[model samples]
Target: MKKNVLRLFVVGLIWLASCSPLTRVLKNPDINEKYQFALEFYENEDYYRAGLVFEDLLPNMAGKAEAENVQFYYSYCQYYQNQFDLAAYYFKQFYDTYRRSDFAEEALYMHAYSNYKATPDYNLDQSNTTKAIETMQDFMNRFPKSSYFEKAGSIINELRGLLEKKAYSIAKQYHRLRRYQAAVIACDNFQKDFPDSELKEEVSFIKMEAQYEYAKASIYTMKIERYEETMEYYYYLVDRYPNSEYMKMAESYFKNTQRELYDLNP
Candidate 1:
């Protein structure tokens, strides 16, 4: 049994070694041979090997007649194999190195999509989301006339919403822990950072609530002054988004703050 296992392993190694030399295959008039071999590997689901062969052909094929098709399918092989990061890198190279190619716009879009695929969950690292959004935005800016405009725009909106949600979560956590000063600052930053965000209503509500809580925790003599600041926030919320559900809540707090001032001074 052990001998049979060892024999099988040796046979596999020999097979791989024979295929390894295919990486050196480049464009001659013999491009057809390399293409045929790569197609066989690709159809057999041996994407890694197919990608290897394609990448090797790149430098030699550059400026040659077959460059465009080779680079396009190379990117596709990486993409189809779920190597999104590598696919994104190759797509970027294709876009930059072959700007005049018919595949340029499509390659650019795929570059952005690859990064978008790499984005982590909202609660995890958002670095990829940030990168994805920025890359998509840049792609849109560069290729506004490209067919990818609307798709890229939709991706930008989705990524922006995720980032806003992260900021709101951090601010809310601070508020929930009674870290009033920190919460106030964080909430303020969120409002400024995403002024036109979908989170405007929730942000305004949190800002008002945090201001009121901070006021409630003040010294007795400073309570009136603090309440005055708190009232300003509520009024701001009501004025800025009158139709918001949060406005009704803010109105209740505004009345409460006014009553507190009267009671304290009377």
Candidate 2:
């Protein structure tokens, strides 16, 4: 019975504290005491309340030694509270404003991390993912020997994966939609841009298939030249990826191209 009563009492106190007006702290007569309490709240991980207090304390504590920590945590508060875009902005601000401060490196990383958090799945627009890659690459370049090197490299690769997936999806969509001409160009670009991608064999094969389809769909004057070009692509893919899973399907295109060559020439 006593434990139950104590639990209710604690819950009630938390409710009251959360419902309490933040202005009470902002209007406190002693700003120094108010700032100290804000830091205490942040240390306790009550970041919402801490952020409220920090917001009020920022102007007062500017240029002070404590401001460094306050600014750094303010961005973290934004991050923890799930305001990732704002967190990214403020983290960049912290890095720029206190470039020489010990927190600068972490702030830079957090800026990129905030963007990474905002970056969504493969199907969504990937502008934020692109931004994160750029920002993280810059961070890695600037801090090559920093402890975050491996983690940063991992994030860059992850971002590249998203980009590669999106590019492949779009190119494949062109092929699926029967826009074989566009698919040919898109697939070519994808191969050129990401030659080392795991999707290399698939990409090359699809472009070859697209080229064959484009040739078939072309006018009489264009068919011969396009078919010849497709044969070149088929040989290239077979030469490079003899064991490709796509070889069976790619072989069909090659046979069709060969038969059409004789018919077109004859």
Total backbone collisions, model 2: 0
Compose the digit string of candidate 2's lDDT tens values, residues 45-70: 98998998887778888668888888
List the global CA lDDT of all models.
0.84, 0.90
- Tens digit per residue, CA lDDT, model 1, 1-266: 99999999999998877675553453334766887677777778788877877777677675677778888889989998888898999999999988998899899999999999888778787899999998999899989998789989999999988888888888989998999878989989998989988787788788888888888888899999889888888877777888988776788888888898899899
Top candidate when judged by lDDT against the true structure: 2
Candidate 2: clashing pairs of residues: none
User: Candidate 1, residue 87: CA error in Å?
Assistant: 1.6
In the order shown, the candidates' Cα RMSDs to the true structure are: 4.2, 5.9
lDDT (Cα, 0-100) at 106 in candidate 2 = 89
